[model samples]
Target: MTDRRLASVGTAAESRLPSRYLTPMDLVAMFRLPSVETVYQWRRKRTGPRAFRVGRHLRFDPVDVRAWVDAQRKEVAV
Candidate 1:
């Protein structure tokens, strides 16, 4: 079963996710940006949300994205 497989293969948090992860294009859409280049730049600069590579593709965890947004909020508010 999907539930069993997910639980057995993933961490507890990953198992709860419902097939959603952020790609560079997803970041562009989330920020209403013009291109995914900005996301790649952020990765190169190490100044954006934490990410990981899945083979040749980059992936951002939703949890890390939320935390990054929160950090940005605190940074700008101060």
Candidate 2:
């Protein structure tokens, strides 16, 4: 079933990567971003949440992503 397959994939990824890190595709989905390419562009411009290289793959810390999202919030005077 699809759920079983997804669980297996998640387990495999967890074994390979640190629990605190997320792939660029994860970021795209989490932030509802346009595309993976947009993630790359943000990385290149240093305009997005901080990311780091993990054996040629990009990884993001959820803490950092949360902070970035908080910093981006706008307040309105009512």
lDDT of 1 by residue, 1-78 (tens): 999987777576555433587898888877898889989999999999999999999999988887798899999999
CA lDDT of every candidate: 0.85, 0.81
For all candidates, what are the clash counts?
A: 0, 0
Candidate 1 pairs with clashing backbones = none
Q: Candidate 2 — what's its lDDT?
A: 0.81
TM-score per model over all chains:
0.74, 0.67
Looking at model 2, the pairs that clash are none
Query: Model 2 — which ten-residue stretch has the worst lDDT?
Result: 69-78
Give residue 30's lDDT in candidate 1 (0 to 100). Answer: 76
lDDT of 2 by residue, 4-50 (tens): 99999977754643457889999888779889999999999998889
lDDT of 1 at 35: 89
Question: Which whole-number lDDT from 0 to 100 does residue 21 have in model 2?
Answer: 81
Cα distance off (Å), candidate 2, residue 37 = 0.4
Q: Can you give the lDDT of residue 61 in candidate 1?
A: 91
